[model samples]
Target: MDLKETHISELLIAGNIDAVKTLTQQAVDDGCSAQDILEKALLPGMDIVGQRFKACDMFIPEVLRSAKAMHGAMSILRPLLIASGVPMVGALVIGTVQGDIHDIGKNLVAMLFEGAGFKVVDLGADVKPETFVQAILDHQASVVGLSALLTTTMPRMAEVIQAIKAAGLREKVRIMVGGAPVTADFAFQIGADGFAPNAASAIEKAKQLV
Candidate 1:
């Protein structure tokens, strides 16, 4: 990494939102492209945050702070990225399945996906199966993520998957499932393409699926 890019990465990991914003702007003023800043600094910083979170070296609060820093930089870069026709890694449609009002986990995963450079369309909690299908089709999303915190609600994930298949949209998108009661076995049984135990792993899984 360039020295300035390395500094930006460190600042991002440290959750220095203001510093990240300032340095990113400076980098732009110094003639660095938005894509270069994202690839070399912002994304690398979030990658470290993900690794640390997975290793238990960082907790939710810390990871959230890092995510905030990344968002700060993205606020500046998003329009530029659009203007430059820079494509996101992938687009994802995520929601907590119907009958499940729980959303903290889903929200965290959405944030992590955004930080990892994916365009995320969050449908919030208590989402219907048809809503997931519509969002996937509307966004032309590559992946669909389902979250269900209760065992009772877990079956809703299967319903969503079934709905996608019934609508002939299954082949167009990869389905990933997770939540407190979700397991890899359950995900497989439901015919989901991938499973994640937590938000960090969700980003990795989404990347692989895409």
Candidate 2:
């Protein structure tokens, strides 16, 4: 691996936005494809961030900082990736279930998904079940992620699954549920395909779903 590639990962994990911006632009100028920059630099950086966060070596705020850096690089690469026809891992629709307005977790997951090469359609906070269903249809998303931070709003995740099923699109996508109040058992009970307690595992689950 080149030193620049390692520097990109280091800058990202260190949450150095300006450095990442400079490096990404430099990579592009040096004839590195958008896909190469992503696969070699950004994604691998975010993967380390995910591992560190999961291992408690990094905190939420720190992870968000790293994600912000990744976002910066992505902002630079997005249009280029499209122009060059870079293939995405998949499309994913993610939202905080209806009745829950919390967005920190949802936003983090969305950014991480983007970093991992998923075309994410974020429905934002306090999202209704119908919105999730419509997003899946609109995006033809292979994976749907439901997040609910409140125990009371956790059932809204189940309602979203029901709505998708009612729309006859249950077979069209794999559904994953998450948030502080969600569990594997609850996900199974609600007919969710997967459950992740945090952003890193959420990426893993979403990738598996797609």
Candidate 3:
């Protein structure tokens, strides 16, 4: 990477949102393509952030700050990226299942998916099963991610799956489940396509699912 690109990545990892935004604008003004900025700078920085998070070297607050930095840079790049005809990796519809108001994990996964190039439609917490069905149809999403922080809400994940099947949309998308109370066995029992233990793995799982 060139010096400017390297600086962009460094600034992003450091959670310097203003610097990231300013340098990203400068890079674009200096003739850098939006794709180059995303691929070489923003994504690489987030890759390191993910690694640190997995290794316990970074905490949630730190990772969130980095995500904010990435968000700032993306604000400048997203329109240009769309205009440049760069295809998204896939579309993802994500939400916290009904009766589950916790969304920290879901939000983290959404940001990670965004960093990894998926177009994410976040339905927020307490999302109804029918909402998931509607969002899948509306977005033509390739992946559906459900999160539940409570064991009680875990069954809601199955309800959403059943609702998708009832709508005949089960085959149209891959379903992945996660959160503190979720397990691979639970995901299997619910007929979900995959389970992610955390936000970082969610990105990998989404990629594999698509």
Candidate 4:
């Protein structure tokens, strides 16, 4: 089969790992740059997968499979992509707030940021404020992304922001918050520098805020 960009994306979505690897390698061998395969095929395919996931048209299994396919292709392209001189946009530390075990949003945002060329340090779910502060200190990150899927845990977002501010890291770092129940106004109320409705917008908001 012809390994067009669309075809490559379809293979990714279908979770045809071997097919994806073969087609992606073929695309590379056919005089296509790995970056072209990444930007045109893999990243765009993940974008669609994420959107479908958000819309409930696709579930976690499909998303994970697509991510796996993307990962496979990226493993082959990393050195080439790095040598092509695409600099990282910035570094980020991300986590779901304390008491919140929901990480789907956090994971999505992490993926989007990575695709957007930002180096992300994921702190995982149920992260305490001190954990985030420690991550910031350790990573020396420019942006901190907080995700909370529950209203009860939403307050922890503010707490984390406050802790960061109290530790004198607030001025140096940009704080961005997201999750189902969070609003722009709440972001302001909680002293967050930025807010986004979802992962894509979170990536855009991070760019703007940083």
Candidate 5:
């Protein structure tokens, strides 16, 4: 990798949003392709973030900051990537389940997925089972994430999964579940492919799922 790519990776890991954008543009001006910048710089930086977060060396706020920096760089590079026909890792459909209005965790997972290079289709909060099923079909998503902060809403995750199966789409996408009240045991009982305890694990699990 070029020195600029290495610098971009360092700046992104440091969560230097402004520097990330500036250097990404400079890399482009210096003849670095957007795909090259994404693969060599941004993705590597986020990969480190994932590793550190999994190891507890990094916390949620710090990970979020790095994600923000990644977004800043992507703002300059995503259009170019699109124009160059660069494909994303995969599409992900995510939402806070029905009867659950809290989206903090779901939103964080979405951002982390985006930082990890997935094309995320976020359905926001209070999402119905059918909505999740349709979003999976609509996006042709490779993964689906269900979130619920309340115990009452946790059952909705299972319902959503069942809906996917009813629609004959359950086999098409890997399902993941998370939230304050969700556990891996519950996720397994519900037939989910994975469970994410936090944002970093969400990225890791999604990677494995894909």
Candidate 6:
């Protein structure tokens, strides 16, 4: 039987790891490009999962399982996706600001960006301003997301932004700030290009920026 697209999405949404693996391979075998599987199946499925989570219809366990399933499928699809030369939506360097170890939010944003077709270079938590600047320069990324869960570390967002500006990279990079204590006003005050309340919003904002 042909693998139905809906079935692939259902398997992903329900966190059916084995079923997703099998069906995804079948999709590849059927001549479906890996990018097609990612964009048409995995990404849409995760979008639903994210919506459910936002609506409180899905718990963290469910979301995590779905993410795991997506990850598994992507592992099989990466080489093909890479070979296809599908231009990425954009490139992003994301990190939790200095002095903050919180990464859950940052990781979520990274995943969302990846799903939305951005090439994400995640600079793990407690990243210094210079690191962000250097990564932006190295990757030639147009967007940078700074995450901070603590009030103390939130100030580092401004520092990072200043560093980017001082390095003459401000004109080229769109800086987005987020996390529990981060506010739109704060982001503006820090000269960030955007601010988001959550990962989903971050993706939306990044799209707008680029």
Q: Which candidate comes out best when scored by lDDT? A: 3
lDDT (10s digit) by residue, model 3, range 31-114? 888777876787778888878988999897888888888878877876676565434798999999999887656876776677
* Model 5 stretches with alpha carbons more than 4 Å out: 1-87
Q: Provide the RMSD of all predictions against the true structure, rounded to 1 decimal.
A: 6.6, 5.9, 5.9, 4.7, 7.0, 5.7
- Count residue pairs with overlapping backbones in model 2: 0
Candidate 1 residue spans exceeding 4 A from truth: 1-87
- The global C-alpha lDDT for each of the candidates, from Candidate 1 onward, is 0.84, 0.83, 0.85, 0.82, 0.84, 0.83
Answer with 3 or 4, whichever has the higher lDDT: 3
| 1 against 6, candidate with superior TM-score | 6
Tell me the TM-score of model 1. 0.61
Q: What tens digits encode model 2's per-residue C-alpha lDDT throughout 46-125?
A: 87887898799999888888878887887787677555533478888999988887775687677667767888899998
Model 6 residue pairs with clashes: none
lDDT of 6 at 65: 83
Report the C-alpha lDDT of model 4 over 118-158, residue by residue, as the tens digit.
88899999999999999999989999999997889999998
Clashes of each: 0, 0, 0, 0, 0, 0
Name the regions of candidate 6 deviating beyond 4 angstroms.
1-87
Candidate of highest TM-score: 4
lDDT tens readout by residue for model 6, 34-94:
7567667876787788789889999978887887787678668766655554358889999
Model 1 poorest 10 in a row by lDDT? 78-87
Residues 122-172 of candidate 5 have per-residue lDDT tens digits of 999999999998888899999999999788989998899899999999889
lDDT of 2 at 36: 75
Against the true structure, candidate 6 reaches a TM-score of 0.62
Give the TM-scores of the predictions, in the order they appear.
Answer: 0.61, 0.61, 0.62, 0.63, 0.61, 0.62
